[model samples]
Target: MDETEELIALCARALVAQMGDVPGVEMALTRNGVLGLTGAPSPDFNRLTLGAGPQAEDFLISSVGRARARGLPLVVVMSPQAQAALAPVAAGLGLTVAGTSPLMVLRPETPVTPSRPVKITRALGVELVAIAGDLEAAAFDEPRDAIARYFDVCLTETAGVEAWIAWDGDLPISAVTVTPTGDTAGISLMATPPEHQRKGWGRALLTQVMADYRSRGVARFHLGSTEAGLRLYESVGFVTVANLSAWLLPAEGALPGRDRGGPS
Candidate 1:
């Protein structure tokens, strides 16, 4: 695999590891794919990651069966190359295209100063889990309870995940998570509520996280970005490495709530 492909794989593995222990979630690793099963009623927790190879289609088919048997929605994450190779196969299976995001990576570079005064601090213990849910609810405009369920399962002590929140005075405005896998640190869930946009909170939060990770000897970082977040990430020296497509099997009856689908 090339540099971009390698980074994508590393990020995918880190995500799976972070979410692997959700109470009812089961993760199965195949030779060319990884499947996450959230045995609960919510479809938002289930995920699949496709690796590069001809077995991509077969792996996806098997994942669909597993998800269906448990009555959960299947969200498939695949790189541009893998998506191209599986397009015809996915078409035949009648899967719906949910959304797509650009995968970005940042190698060690000169640090950029934040335009605003923002203080970022790590969230420890249960505070970390609560902050994660709260940030997602505020950023996505969803119910806090629904988002909390995800954090409750995914943010344990052994999950190898760390969360940080950006504060303006005593109020928290932005949040992000960093997970280390091999030599690469995957940065994800960078979020700021609609009311706080354009104030440099996102940039400040990311700059702090990047600096902290770099201090720990981590030189590489990866994340998938939405259209609204693309500019902020680019401002911090992140470049597009690949485009990732998420194919969703919409659940019955309007689907519980809106899922950001890809990484934030």
Candidate 2:
């Protein structure tokens, strides 16, 4: 992989490292570029990402079998480069394409200037993280505790991530997380409640966060975005670098071809 793609993969690795830190979560990093995280509160957390590698097919089968053994719903994620070959393989294993997300990146030289002035705060303690989690859950319409379980891990100082929140007085209004990996930083879990949409709070929060990181001598930032979030990310000078394909198993039971053991 080239430098930009390698940076993207590093961000992903950093993210899974954070997920693995949460109490009982199990993580597997395979030599063939498959990453599995199981036993989290949601299937999204229990994901297996397939990166570009020569033994990807065999690696994927083994990874899925492991998740099956754990009896957890699994979501498989693949980069654009990996999807063309793996999509059919994923289907044969009883998985179907769920959605696609754009991988976006921003270099330090690009300016991120929010249209309005706003105050933002860093989440310090467990209480603040929980509050930020609540805001995130509300924004995404996900179960609060499921999201909080992951957010809480950000409190670990060496986890390479920092959580930030924007408040409306006592109410936590917006939340974002930045994971700094060497010279590049990955932005994730940015949220603002539906009621507060179009108010430019997202812009303000993102700008401030990027500015803070840039001041610290980190220039590059990257993230994956849903279609709904594309415009907002684009407004902040982020451009799409890749489209990641995601697949999910039919249900939480046995995988289709598990009996036909795969090559490790």
Candidate 3:
């Protein structure tokens, strides 16, 4: 793969590793220019697919149709370029497209060093914590041991499997995971408890991860975000680079049977 494609692939794999525990999510290859989105995605989280020829509009319409037919949301996650080419059809479908989380890529040229140094020491007993049991009961609300096991498989099976629950003392507040892809690093499984809002813990965990990536010579760091989380990401130096969106059709929509797809 060329540089761009390679970067996309690295990002995709990192995503897969992060969400691998979410039973509904999976990674599937896409046609040139497109990729699949997997992992318990809402109908709004359809595949970050590529485009076809001049008929790209028609193709998107068809993909949207099939997703809604399965009682699944047809979410199209795409880069800025892909989103631009397919906007006409996307807007017609009541799609909501937003920027990927602003990511501060640690390029040698990326300016503005962090205000303070990050303290990343050991993985054992430390200021970090983790809960490995099935999170569906609380986090996902689906409540099934099997569902929780999904994450276990992903975390244990992968090479870069580290989950963190940052704490000021004994109480748990924020959480984040770091995964690697090629020469870059990916951040996944980020969460902060409701009571922990506005506390700097979330940014602290994220900054710590980014610093680690910098030390490793990672060319880029990647993230996806919702409108609510945009400001938080911006503070760390991420930009408006790509977007993923999809249409929400009623049952028996156009093309029936297209699986929830996009990413790799």
Candidate 4:
């Protein structure tokens, strides 16, 4: 694949590793894109990230239908590369633009480090993994149960994915996840709770993680950045590759067949 396509594929692979086996989740690989449904209340977990290809429209429509069938909201993540080909199709399917983020790739350089280093460690055991999930949920204002469930599966079983957390003595301060695909690695779900936002923990954890991964020979890194995170990422040498537009399909009020992590 070419450079842009390779970055997109890294995103797809990282997403699949995190969501593939989260109990009530379902995933489908289209001709060039990926569809994921977590059956969670949050739209963040239900997505269709399109790729640049002839079948992009078909994959989008079918993915929307799948979400509607389950009575859930769906978010379609489209990069500028795919928007020319799929935006009209998404509009025809009744998806409305919800938000936009930047898709970024790290430049070839040492990651930026915080002036004062903080203790950061890989989330190795079940308890630490669960703590990582808790921090993520708080950071993003997502449902705790659903986020926790995804991280539990991701930390316990996903081979390519790994999580790290910054700590203050015995308490956790920030968390992030990384998934390596060949020389490229995808950074995701970086979190620092509201109370801890101003501290340098996030920068510390991010730089340390990237540097450690670099030591392991991972030459490139990519991530989708919220407006709040753009500066932080750019400070560490990540350049915007594409503008990612998010389109949302409101829920139809149909209940999911099974709600994972909730009373059955």
lDDT to native, each model? 0.73, 0.74, 0.51, 0.80
Candidate 1, residues 1-264, lDDT tens digits: the string is 886567667766776876766555567776557887755455556788776776777788877766665556678888788888887776666567888888888876645445555788776667766876788789877667656655545676677887788988888899888888756788877778889888878888888777767778888788988899899888888899788888886444223444323221
After superposition on all CA atoms, how large is the RMSD of candidate 1? 4.5
lDDT accuracy of residue 186 in candidate 2? 86
TM-scores for the candidates: 0.87, 0.89, 0.64, 0.91
**Which predicted model would earn the best TM-score?**
4
lDDT, candidate 3, 21-79, per-residue tens: 55455344444333333423344234544433454566566655545544455555544
Which ten-residue region of model 4 has the weakest summed lDDT?
Answer: 255-264
Ranking of models by lDDT:
4, 2, 1, 3
List the candidate numbers ranked by TM-score, top first: 4, 2, 1, 3
Compared with the true structure, the alpha-carbon lDDT of candidate 1 equals 0.73
Clashes of each: 0, 0, 24, 0
| Model 3 lDDT at residue 172 | 54
Off by over 4 Å in 2: 31-34, 255-264
Model 4, 1-264: lDDT tens per residue? 556666776677777888886787889986567888887766787878877777777788888888877777888887677887777888887788898879899866646454456788788787888888889999988778878767667785446789999999999999999998887789999999999997778888898888878889888889999999999998878998788788998775344663322210
State the number of backbone clashes in model 4.
Answer: 0
Candidate 2 lDDT tens digits, 1-264: 764347546755765756766666666676435454536535676777677678778878877777776556688878766688787788887788888888888977787665666678888777887778888888988877667666676556677678889876776778898888777888888899899888888888888888888889888898889888899999889998788788886335655654321211
| Model 4, C-alpha of 6: deviation from truth (Å) | 2.2
Q: What is the lDDT of residue 174 in candidate 2?
A: 88
